[model samples]
Target: MKTTFISTQAVSSATRLSIMKMQAELAKNSKELGSGRWADVGLELGNKTGRTVSLRQDFARLDSIKDTNGLVMSRLDGSQAALEGMLKMAQDFSASLIGVRTGDTGADVIQDDAKNNLQALIASLNTSIDGEYLFAGIDTDVRPVTDYYATPVVPGTGPKAAVDDAFLTAFGMAQNDPAVINITPAAMDAFLNGAFAAMFDPAAWTDPTTGWSSASDQNVRSRISTSELVDTSANANEAAFRKIAMAYTMVTEFASSNLSEGAYQTVIDKAAEIVGEAISSTTVVMARLGTAQERVKNANDRMDVQMKILNTHINDLELVDPYEAQTRVTALETQLDMAYALTARAQQLSLLNYL
Candidate 1:
């Protein structure tokens, strides 16, 4: 074996290098011990870094979806509540129409109530959540229903106008005319179930030069999850709303003096029929909303579970065993102390000091 002699300068340099390395290890272990995760994940994970990055990206995307799903759930809840309110109003109005005397002075009171209910129904249909109109379909910025009190002066311009035109064209009378009692089921059929009904159709909405026009894009949809898109809102363009509005219009206009008692009763009966049908249709829409809300809730549940699993995976990749890290930190502290002691000793071993 050949004998090797190392110079004092070389020994000092080597000692300094060893102490620096020990200090680096001490810092890393201390950080891991305090944080319970790897301080340098890339260094620790190496080839697995890509997988960790990908998992985090997935988490971010999922979190974003969950946020959107929460908003959608809120919108659905609001829509359901509004529809329920409208249905209740319609039900009450229908129940009031029963067995009413044609000469009842309460017609004014009832008409007043009908106007209030109509306004409330419009308010409900125009419900907004977080500043977005839930019933406005894709046109969230536009209100879905124009105020019912607006005169139908411009034919074919708005809901009130559409309704007024249908009545004038069908019955040869203004909507308030007592002769509306002459409107047979055949005449009311078109208003209730035919072309006039189609006017309330989402597809029939045209670009009126003004406020919300009935456009075919009525149902509002939201992506609840990566793989799922759901219709989260119902628009006001459904037949139910039109039926209610028309009935309300007729009832609010009804006065005992406008017609013979028999004719007034006939109008009341027709209003009842229309409002009843509106109630049924509103119920159906509520049922559909219930189903949609349930689907969104289920998706949220699924995402919650997936998020837990993903967190676990992320922890496995990036977290350190707390106990092990503490032990390593203590060991590194001891090694660092020993290296400092050795370096101090090395500084004293210079050849010039020996001289």
Candidate 2:
């Protein structure tokens, strides 16, 4: 019989190596038990790890879109509220014009109300959230409308100065000139339809030297979902906004009380027509925004369902059974304790102890 001699040092080294391996497994199982997830997702899932990776990416994308849709909805709600307010102002101004069609309401009262409404309209267009103007279209950093009543810091660079220049260019005189009484309905209508209308054009209104609005013609667009992109902002350069400005300017700047009866009637008639168009256009814009809001909401609903399905799939691939993990952890701990006790006993086994 051949006897195999193994040194005590070799026996102790082998026991220690086995104990270290069991300790490592114990640590891994302990973590899995606590977290209820696989300790090594890539190791456990192997080639199918790519599927979880793709699903997780899709889940993250849907979460990002859902977050962005919240902001888009906020902007749309703000825009709708502002447009509704503008529509109300147009309705009230139109009613005021009708009240004065019989020449019963004082011109001064109408002029005062028009000036206030114009200022309010500009303020509304310049509405902002976190320093971003809602009606600035894609030019969110810029204010959409300039204050028409603001005194020009420069000689000919203010919104009021631009109006004055247009008025002078059209009529050969200032707005307050006493000779305005001699202005005929034909000449006033021509001026209103021509030079005055041109002032609110997107190109002219964005002119650096003399402009009423700095808003972009292109509105802000947002992706509400993986497939849906929608416009999320309004622009001050919309014809509805321009017409409201024109109607308000006609009453405020035309020296309404000084005009001949026929010319005053023409101004009122033109303002009434413009106000009606503004109201109709605003209603259309509101309806479009409402539609966008509904689409965004639906997109979120669909994304939520997709995310839930994705999470379930991911959990199946990446999560561990906590009860099984805990049982393995308990077994490994018992093995480690026994292995440590044996390793210690093996180290203690020396011939000198028997001596």
lDDT of 2 by residue, 31-133 (tens): 8888889889999999999999999999999999999898888888889889988999899999988888646355778889899999899989999877889
Q: lDDT tens string, model 1, 302-342? A: 99888889999999999999989888888888887887888
| Stretches of model 2 off by over 4 angstroms after superposition | 1-15, 102-105, 340-353
Clash number for candidate 1? 3
Report backbone clashes per prediction.
3, 0
Model 2: worst 10 consecutive residues (lDDT sum): 99-108
Global lDDT of each candidate: 0.75, 0.87
Q: How does model 2 fare in lDDT?
A: 0.87
Instruction: State how far residue 349 of model 1 sits from its true place (Å).
Output: 9.1
Q: What range of 10 consecutive residues in model 1 has the weakest lDDT sum?
A: 207-216
Instruction: Please give me the total number of clashing residue pairs in predicted model 2.
Output: 0
